[model samples]
Target: MRVVKAPDVRRSEILAAANQLFQTQGYSRTSVDQIVNKVRIAKGTFYHYFKSKEQILDALADQLVLDMAYHSEQIANHTQLNAIEKIVTIISEQNRLQSEQQNVVDSMHLPDNRQLHERINIKIVLTFGPILATVIEQGNQQGLFDVKDPLSTIQFILAGSLFLFGEGVFNWPPEQAQARIQSMIILIERTFGAQPGSMIIALNQCLNEEKR
Candidate 1:
């Protein structure tokens, strides 16, 4: 007897196959036929789940944001770590993922990919802001942060950190990037009323670990 897969399960299988192909073959080189062939699904089935290759890319971007949020939430939920530690862990994880996926990052630097890159960034901030805000709210309760609005504060931080320091934007020198990072830390600390230099220490520690 053969079994039937649920719609959502089938959709995820398609996404999984597409993600693997996109990572291995490059997104622009991968096609609908390849994705369906990998999954042994009909072309029509792929269209049922996604209208086009671009739509699959959009879904992949959404998955990336959700995966990041899920990991950040896990750090935020850790009982032993304070709010600052959770934030640091989240940042560190993000940096680690970025390093691991440098190919994906570099693809976004292509001139033709600018629109898709911008769309992905918007999706990331929309999905990630609330998760970060939860951490900020916890900080407020613990008296580590004194911001009146966690959501808005997170949005502002993400705008600068995501767009300004993000790849393919300013193309800053190493020294300039470091300076901007330091300034961002200071801005975040001051805006939320966190202790001076604490965020800097955390960021430095994360960067140091990335070297090893």
Candidate 2:
């Protein structure tokens, strides 16, 4: 394996540690002092790369986008699943992420949560929206989806999926959470309504959407 430079390697390690800590603990509760203490570095060294706590958080958001993009690639490459199946897989992954995040006491409960949530939404859109679009276009071309606007359909799916995540986090009665996700997915699948013998056209439209 090629060796990474010491500083870049160290920076990534530090950021990874910080991301976990800050995500699990409230941003307000996490401190650079705590980060340095866990990273086993001196406070002076922590300050050398990051001037303020806010800067580190900004970096964390950037990293989140990169991770989401990685996930999108994984969704696109599932061989046994076609476009419609991939959409279900996408939502499944989102559900898994929501479950993981629920354990974290983050700023999502605070007044400033709106700002953070919007930022996260924008990142999610940028990273995964294209993948959703490709699937929608494929479904439409194959007559599997009756949607006239593939773009708008993808947008709705993204928004709806996030809403499911919100309900899981905020709604009471675990069964309600399950019902919400199932209802949304049912809505999406009905909207798409995949049919047999359309795989060829589906693949073509998916490729065309990627070119757009």
The residue ranges of model 2 lying beyond 4 angstroms of the native Cα positions read 1-7, 23-28, 97-105, 141-143, 160-183, 193-212
- Which residue runs of candidate 1 sit more than 4 Å off their true CA positions? 1-4, 97-109, 205-212
lDDT of each: 0.79, 0.62
Clashing pairs in 2: none
Error of 2 at 102 (Å): 4.9
lDDT of 2 by residue, 127-201 (tens): 677777876776666566766676667777776655545422464365655555455545655566644333334
C-alpha lDDT of candidate 1 relative to the true structure: 0.79
**What local lDDT does model 1 show for residue 2?**
37
Q: What is the TM-score of each candidate against the true structure?
A: 0.83, 0.67
lDDT of 1 at 99: 63
lDDT of 1 by residue, 1-212 (tens): 53468999999999889878878878779889999899998898889889988777767766666777788878878889878998899989877776665446556656777887888788777877888898899899999999899998898888767777666778788888777777777888899899887677887777545433
- For every candidate, C-alpha RMSD to the true structure in Å: 3.0, 8.1
The 10-residue segment with the lowest total lDDT in model 1:
203-212
